[model samples]
Target: MSSQARVSRQIIIQPTGEKPRKDRPMVHYKDRAELKDSVARAARTVWPGNARISVEITGHWSACTGRIFVNNRDAASFAPIVPRTAPETEAFDFGGQAS
Candidate 1:
């Protein structure tokens, strides 16, 4: 007889304030080291930066799931800021000569 296992994963992204659109593809590993390696590879590809990553694994022998959290540097500071203003009521003269 054959048995099946249930697996799932969740990836959380920080600083960018974004999350994965869907669960990551499940992967089977022979040992804990293999699982760590796989997760590390995925993390590098998903968040390539000087970010902190953490993984949580849970489940019984027949199945396993994980959650990966990545805290990246804030990127909003590089964005340009635009000032909001009301519409001009009158047209101003651009030339040096007074209107």
Candidate 2:
């Protein structure tokens, strides 16, 4: 890795539910870069690059939490993180009719 590489990368924050809440928008990103951008934009508003970010899971199951660990810390110390794609939907989504 190059020294110029960003030591402070962007962190992601997302909410989890069986179905997305209609009232509240669920954060979705096209790719990792987009996610990073969103995080950077938010962090810039509040705190500068001095602070580091971590993701947490506050749901029933760890798997559903969609939490990610950037630094040595677990996805709990900071905020919650979610992937661009949901883990369950990663494989395939069932059709209208059941098999």
Candidate 3:
């Protein structure tokens, strides 16, 4: 993308991909945490095994909502969620000359 384009010649561009969707799908509660809990309970009922069943919800809030499906029967390939990094401390270098 060139930054030198004049305002008059600029063309509006829309983002491509699965547009924004709500992390919470249902309209029952306005909270994403609430939805997660509700889904966990429902999932437990559906999957009785204690082998480790996890539910992940993702999407934007306005556009098309998300749906859930089970993939435990086969190895589910997924990228782990990246953890937020800690804030860095600003450094002030002291003159190397010995006191």
lDDT of 1 by residue, 11-30 (tens): 23222345433434334444
Tens digits of per-residue lDDT, candidate 2, 1-99, equal 222222222233332333332232223333344344444344333334435644333342212223434343332222333335646553232111112
If ranked by lDDT, best first, what sequence of candidates would result? 1, 2, 3
Q: What is the lDDT of residue 58 in candidate 2?
A: 37
Tens-digit lDDT track of model 3 for 1-99: 323211111111111233322222222223444444544444444445645544444453111123334444321212111113512221111111112
TM-score of 2: 0.26
Clash counts per candidate, in order, are 0, 4, 5
Model 2: residues with Cα > 4 Å off, grouped in runs? 1-28, 48-78, 81-99
In the predicted model 3, the residue pairs found to clash are 21-59, 21-60, 22-59, 22-60, 22-61
Best-fitting candidate, measured by lDDT?
Answer: 1
Better of 2 and 3 by TM-score: 3
In angstroms, the error of model 3 at 84 is: 42
What are the models' TM-scores? 0.39, 0.26, 0.32
lDDT (CA) for every model shown? 0.39, 0.33, 0.30
- In model 3, which runs have C-alpha deviations exceeding 4 angstroms? 1-28, 61-99
Model 2 RMSD in Å is 11.6
